[model samples]
Target: MAVTQQLARVSGAYITRCRASAAVSPDADPEWDPPAEDWIDLDWSPRFLRDACELAGVDSPTLEALNYALNGDASVDVSVLSHPEATGGFGPTPTALTPASVADVAAKLAGLDWDRVMAEIPADCRETIAGGDFSGDPLAYLTTHFMALRDFYVEAAQRGLFVVSWWD
Candidate 1:
């Protein structure tokens, strides 16, 4: 089975459920249940994840440092192009994204040199991408998909909401 990456916006109801779930014992709230559904699905392929992560302005020592500082450590960004799982996001999860962090990601993504990013895609990753319809325009593909991801984060952050991203 192929493991495609998935990102979703976490609703307030989901957050409430999470808090309640954590606060209450498992046996207490028979009606309470862990969140199992996603509200906003930003479906991104592993190859896209790989390339976006390495985007010129998107990947920098300073940006990574800030991200690490903002978000603790321990959320795995699984390997897309033979890369190891990345623990702790600059934003939140795989679990959450803050207003500030979402803005940061948007800014970073907007300022990215998409051409440079696509040009830098590793050989193995390129091979993987070649298997799909990614030959048209990498930057365009990234913008279309990443824009959705960015917008989801921005909107969620603005509403004091959180977005949970995980892949199964």
Candidate 2:
């Protein structure tokens, strides 16, 4: 099964509610909804971005930012927000980035050397992307989703909102 990544910008209060609800019943499937504009579906681009970041030797906040964007930063954990079925029983649970982490990631993404990274992707990960292979124009695809993810973080940071990431 193909796994796709999703990110949602939510308020601290919402996160608190989710945590409380999960604590009450860890197995309950509550309706987890954020506004349309607050969410992004990154498809498999995060894996590509993370791989590209690694190949390019992107460091610290930038590298960490991409990693967190794909896999959560562990700022908050709420198991009820995800289901094993959604992940094909082999994917990460829903995890969040606090507003502070969101701000930090936004700043890091803003300073990322995208051109350099993009130029190095083919040499870095082309035929060795671990679980799967690249399709179409990897550079263009990664660029589109990378920009979207970066913009999503910037917006979330500006609003002082938390970001929750999951795979489904």
Candidate 3:
């Protein structure tokens, strides 16, 4: 069956389940009444839907169904709210530091013995780091930084250090 059809079927099943689980009025038409907004509000984001699908090991058809349930036919952008906390806890936590405070943090990080960590990076990465090409080839610099951070994380983990989870 097509993914869209499968999704629709799954959605039907979900609605059926919801109706069965709830007390229905005999004279009331369940199909005529849509679910409450709160029902849809709970974990209805595209990313949440995608993650749920992945975790449930749902097939493409089921995933399509899940997507349809969340937001019908429209292509949802999961990256819409990249930093939720930045919007005063509605998203990500806002940065407590001002520009000067951020600069101070950067200066402190710069003073650390990063040379030893950077030495482990491959030769190709060194060129990108040395060039400081933040505008062009940001990925190259990001890759290098990611590796360095990964290495640091591994070392920290080995020592049983607690690392806070943060999405890149």
lDDT of 2 by residue, 1-168 (tens): 576888889998887776566567656534466788898989877766887788877886678777876677754765667655322334666788888988988999988978888776665465554335555766777788889999999999999998988877
TM-score attained by model 3:
0.22
Scanning candidate 3 in windows of ten residues, the lowest lDDT window is: 1-10
lDDT of each: 0.45, 0.76, 0.31
Q: Is candidate 1 or candidate 3 better by lDDT?
A: 1
Model 3 residue 60 distance off true place after TM-score fit, in angstroms: 16
How far residue 56's Cα lies from its native spot in candidate 1, in Å, is: 5.5
Candidate 3, residues 52-121: lDDT per residue as tens digits? 2354344565444334333332222212212332111143311122223223323333333334334444
**Ranking of all predicted structures according to TM-score, beginning with the best and ending with the worst:** 2, 1, 3
Q: What tens digits encode model 1's per-residue C-alpha lDDT throughout 24-108?
A: 6443331322243434333444345444555434557435522432231244321111112221223223444544555565555
The most accurate candidate by lDDT is 2
**CA displacement after TM-score superposition, residue 163 of candidate 1 (Å):** 2.3
